[model samples]
Target chain A: MLKIDNLHATAGDKEILKGISLTVNAGEVHAIMGPNGSGKSTLAQIIAGHPGYVVTAGSVTYEGKDLLAMPAEERAQAGVFLAFQYPVEIPGVTNAYFFRSAYNEVRKANGKEELDPIEFLDLMEKKLKLVEMDEAMLHRSVNAGFSGGEKKRNEILQMAVLEPKLAILDETDSGLDIDALRVVAGGVNALRRPDNATIVVTHYQRLLNYIVPDFVHVLAHGRIVKSGGKELALELEARGYDWVMEAA
Target chain B: MATATNATGEAYEQAFGALRAQGGPSWLPALRREAMDRFSALGFPTTRNEDWHFTSVTPIAERVFKVAPTRSGPATLSPADVAALVISDPDWHRLVFVNGRFEASLSAFAGLPADVRVTTLADALKESPEFVAEHLGKLASGEGQTFTAFNTAFAQDGVVIHVPGGEIVEAPVHIVHIADAQAAGAGIHPRLLVVAEALSRLTIIESFASTGSFGAPYLTNAVAEIEVGNGARVDHYKIQRESTDAFHVGTTQVRQGRDSMYHSFSYAAGAAISRTNVYTQLAGENGETRLNGLYLIDGTQHADHQTFVEHLAPGCASRELYKGILDGSSHGVFNGKVYVDPVAQKTDGKQTNHALLLSEHARVDTKPQLEIFADDVKCTHGATVGRLDEDALFYMKSRGLGAENARALLTYAFAAEVLETIEVDALREGLEALAFARFTQSFGEQR
Candidate 1:
């Protein structure tokens, strides 16, 4: 479903993603694990078309189309989603309003009829149960004064509402407690379909236990150095990343 | 330049003389004479004045505007035309003024209580002379204000509202001031006097608008004085949406008695140059006052708001919030000051001003001043000027909103922070629709 060939990118004057290549097929869950400052989040943001990063030399093909040539919003309309590490606080925009606008935009782009507020609210109630979030949160400002776990859960709620084909979970498990992690992982697992895919980026192996991945890749110094089965995550968690770095 | 200024001053003097020649009322001639003298002495404020540093009234000073005729004449506006220019609601007690003259045919106050009195200032002078004499030109004096003096000297007609003690007014009083094409190249001064007696409650909406795309240059100098008696509550809303080629200067003075409450909201969205000043005095213990304002302008427009609150008694509180949205080289200014006297202890005051610039050339100036002579008081003030948050914009765009849609949404949200506080439903909805349409249209033009 996605292909990245020798992705060389930089933010400002410093190179972040050196030389990296990865491929993922349909219905497969991939986990990219690394230590701090290993470009795990950068790789996820680049795939979502964050404008801060400069892709000097690389090619990212999504469903046989060059993805790097599209703007961030266009990429979003084309079924790309990024669950932010730190969700933004829009002071006066309600979560329900934001979700409705986003859902209608994606629908319009895909040549589908837009849903009215009543229709959208009916669909939103079902998604709210998946994340175990209170309906009151939808009326409040988006992410303003929300708890860390609530923000992470809100991200998942958006992902469920949009139903993007390619979802990149960038450090989604950073600030969540154990209970929140279970609920979030459960929500993601429920949305897994035969034609869609997910790339979970994380620094620890705890999140993988709930939403088990089919393939595990260790990213060190902006390069994928090790690839193995689900057992590889347990091996790296037990031994640490230094061995993999030395081998690379 | 001196000759031009003299010419403008002489023109006003001639108009004042013309008004006096046809005036009634035994006690009005002296008041008008004194005010005219004060206006001549004060003249138009220059940029050198500290209060007028950020704003220049050169455009208003250079022009010589005649007094608009009292009658509508050939530019006769119908009831439907008047309804379309204001927040039309059948339940509201309304008074319509055209070119500073009361249009009784267009006004309605059918079922008001016997004790409550709502009429024109000109009629009140004849009906209840002593009551009109007690409050008129008292709180909003022409001592140090040039525009207030100008209004006092030239105001031919306006609205006068009086609520007796302990009477709760059910419907709001809506005062509509319209300037038609006949008012082109002329000046009109409209006055408002509201008196809420002890334990009474009232709401007043004063709106200024132009008639049907009237684009000629005119001047609207308006003044309002509100008296909140002991334990009384009053909510005053002033909305200014003049023609884009016109100029507006308005002043609102408020006095609160023991345990009284006063709330003032100013909304400015039109006019080439506009200035609004709100001043309040807490005269008795445990009084509360709130001053809130919002201004949205674009296309070389200039808008300014100046507010002052004085704490004279112990246990008084005041709060202020002003927000502005400027685009297309527009300029906005906010100057707010709070004073706590030596006798006023345990006073609580807070002030905040924020401005959002939508274009690269848009500008804003905010100044917050606090003068405290009391030992036990809590006061704080803050000001912020910034563009839209880039991260928030990106976050919205990532959720599938296009760049233009994201910017417009964020800009409207910034304005919604203040619009949400309006207690009146019809007025709030009207302003919200206007703001939404404005931002969307401007952003669409940019694209």
Candidate 2:
């Protein structure tokens, strides 16, 4: 469902994603593991179409459609979702109102009818139960005064509502506790289907324990140095990315 | 700094001249003449005036505003028109006006509480000349103020609300003022007099808005006198969302009796330049007072709030909080002061003003002052000027909200605190819609 070939990106004069490439098909979860400054997160951001980081070379296509040509919002409507490491807080805007607007935008993009208040509420009720999140969260401002874990849960809550085709979890496991991780992972696993995909970007191998990935790639120095099956994450955790960096 | 002065100055002189014919009790014309003499004596305020510091109204002073809609003041509001500003509570009564003039033909005053009474200023003047003579320009008025003198001289028709003694109104009351800008250079000077008798209760909302694309640079200068009698309670809200090019200057002077409670909540979002002044005097011991304001400005809009609270009697309490969010090149100012007399002991007062600058070009100037002569009193005052928390902004973005959307939401939330302070549901809802639209436009959609 997603393909990136020799991604070359930079922040100003400094290069971040030098020449990294990866591909993920439907129903498959791919984990990109790397150390600090290894450009793993940059690859995820560039793919999400964050402006600031100039994509100088390479190409990314989703379902054979040009990805880099679209704006961040359009990319989102195109089923490209990114679970940011930190969530933004919007005061006076309730979770219900925000999610409804987002859902309608995407549905409208796909030539689908917008859901009325009642219909939207019903959809959110089901997703709320799926993520084990309460309606109380929907009544409050968007992520205002929410905890780290709750924010990550909100990210998953939005993911569940939008039901994206290719989801990019950018350090999604950074702030979650043990129980939260299980809930988040369960929700993510529940959404996995043959027509959708997941790309887990993390510096640790712990998140892989709940929702195992089909392929684990060690990203060091802005390039993929090693690629293997799920066992590769455990190997990287035990030995560290120093070996991967040296090999690169 | 090249002001629109010559225009406003000429306009003020013209409006002030045409109003001299509105003779009341002979004392009133004498007062107007004196005020006019004082205004000209004062001339246009320079930076030297302490109150005018940081705010150079020279531009406002120069531009001339054509005499307001008085020529076509009384307007008809259809039921559809009322719905645009209606609050859904069937329990209360409402009196809607068009451009500061009373429109009894279109207003509904059925089944009003017995103790609650209302009359147009013109009607009240004819029915009870005693009350008009006794209270006219009684609380506060001055020729030193060009606009106040102007409003007094014109002394156009307004509303007089009196909640009789021992009557506590269960429902709210609204006075909606809509301006017709179809007439070029027309202006509106709406006035209000609210008197809550002993042990009475009242809630009033005074809103100023405009319709049509007359597109002329009109102006509105308004003043309200509120009196809360002994043991009475009053919640007053002033919502000003005039046209973007309109200039609004208003004053609210309140007098509280022993053990009375008075609250003033104001939200300013429109107008090219707007200034609202609130003055309250704790006349009797144990009186309570609160003054709050939320002014959100973007682009070239400028909003300024100046307030003063006095503790004349002992055992009184007062609180004031004003917040603003400025985007683009908009500017904001807040100057608040609390005064405690020597005999006014046991006064508990707190004042706080904060501004959140949303852009580098957006500027805010805030100052809080306290002058206490009493020995036993608790007084606190503070002012803060800054921007939205960056950490807070990034946190919103992390939740799939774009950077612009995050900023917009946070700014709206920042101003929501002031909106919540509005006790009137209809007024609050109206303000909420306006503030939401404002921030949304500035920050755009973030879905």
Candidate 3:
């Protein structure tokens, strides 16, 4: 469902993604692990169409369409979702209102009827339970003063509501406690389907225990240095990223 | 003494001549005489004056606006037309003024409480001369304020609301100042006097509107003098919705007594050139003052809001938040000052002015002044001018909202910070609708 070939991207004068290639099919969950500043998050941001990075020398194809050619909003409407590691805090805008606007926008783009307040509330209630979020969070400003774990849960709640075809979780496991990690991972595990895909990008191997990945890839110096089945994650966790870095 | 040139000077002289011809109350002539002398001395405040540095009244001065005919027979507008201009609150006691004169037919004074003395200023002067004489022009002085001086000198008819001591007015007093098109190229001075006695409570909604479409530009120079007595509470809201070609210069002066509360909100949504000055002084201990404003200007419109809050007594608090959203070639200016006097120990004051520019030609100039003379007082003021947050825009876009819709929503949210502070339900909803319409229209005009 997704393919990246020799993707070389730069942010300003510094190159972040150099000669990176990856592929993923439907129903697959892939984990991309790397040390800090190893381009793990950069790859995920580029896929989600963040404007800060320029794709210099490669193409990204999603279902035979040029994904990079679309704008960020268009990519979202096309069922590409990015759960930002640091969700922007927008004061004076309620979480429920923001979610409703976003949900209706995607619906309108797909030629679906928009849901009214009542219908949207019902959907939100259902999704809130998936991530174990309190109903009070809906009335507060969007991510304003929310705890780190609550912010992560809110992102997963959005994912559940939008039901995107391809989801990228960038550093979703970072800064989460054990219980919050389980809640977030459990929601993702429940939403997985054979027709949908997910890419988990993290700096730790602990999240793989909750939402086990079909494959694991070690990213070093903006390139995938090692690729293997799920066991590779345990191997790296026992050792360290240094072994993979030296080998690459 | 300094004097204006050409048409501007002639307009003042014409107003003085008319005031002489029309006999007023016993004290009115002397007050008008003093004001005329002050106007002649001050002329018009130029940019050279620090207070008027960002806003110029040259456009208003250049055009000559004759005095609107007082008691212009009967208003030709129907009740439905009047209803459209008001907030349509059934319980609100309304005093409707047309072309600066009392429209007794449209006013609903009988609905007010028995203890409340709500009547037109003209009627109050003739009937209750003592009450009118004691409080009128006491809180709002025309000494240094150019527009207040002009308004006081030529004032005709406005609302005079006096709630006796210990009386609580449940329903808000609505004062509607409608400038009819018949008074084209005319100047209408509408004055309001609100006196809430000790332990009393009252709410006032003052609306300045134009009756016809843009054509000949008129001027509405208004002044509202509010006095909140000891332990009293007062909420005052002023809505300026004049014609696109019209000009408005308004002054709202409030003084709070011991343990009193004063809340004032001004929304400037119309007029080619609109300047609103809000000044408040905490005269007693434990008084609370809140001054909030929102100005949305588009096209070639210009809106200026100058606010001054003085902390005279100890244990007083004041908060001010003014937000402006400018689109097209519009310009906005906000100058807010919070003064903590030497005797105002333990005074807590905060002031913030934020402006959002939607287009390249749109501009805003904001200055927040904090003068702290008390050693133990806490005062802070900040001013920020910028376009919309790009990161916020992208975040919204990635959530599937269109770029235009996202930008419009952000702009609306920025204005809501001030709009939401309004305690009146009907007024808040009405302003929200007006703001929404303005944003939609302007955002659609953008590329």
Candidate 1 residue-wise lDDT, A78-138, digit = tens: 9889999999998777898889998998899899999999999899999999999988989
Docking class of 2: incorrect
Encode model 2's per-residue lDDT on A17-112: one tens digit a residue. Answer: 878888899989999998988887788877777666898899998899888987676778778888877777766678897888778767887899
Put down candidate 3 lDDT per residue, B169-225, tens digits, no spaces: 888888988887777888899999999999999999998887776468889999999
Candidate 3, which segments miss by more than 4 Å at Cα?
A: B70-74
Question: By TM-score, who's the top model here?
Answer: 3
Candidate 1 chain B, run of 10 with poorest lDDT: B1-10
Q: What 10-residue stretch in candidate 3 chain A is worst by lDDT?
A: A85-94
Q: What is the two-chain DockQ of model 2? A: 0.17
What does candidate 1's lDDT look like per residue over B1-447, in tens digits? 112367788888988898999766788898899999888888888878878889898888888778887683543777898778876577888888888888888889867888999989989988988898889999999787888998999998888899999999988899999998878888899999999999999999998999755546899999999999999999999999988978999999999999999999999998999999999999999999999989999889999999999999999999898999998899999999899999999999999999999889999988888999999999999999999998888888888888888898899888887887789888888888888888877889889
Residue A154 of model 1, lDDT score: 97
Question: Relative to the unseen true structure, what is the C-alpha lDDT of residue B216 in candidate 2, on a scale of 0 to 100?
Answer: 64
- Which scores better on lDDT, 1 or 2? 1
**What tens digits encode model 2's per-residue C-alpha lDDT throughout B40-132?**
556556657777676766555655556555434445567577556543344556677776667776567666676577877778777776776
Docking class of 3: medium
lDDT of 2: 0.80
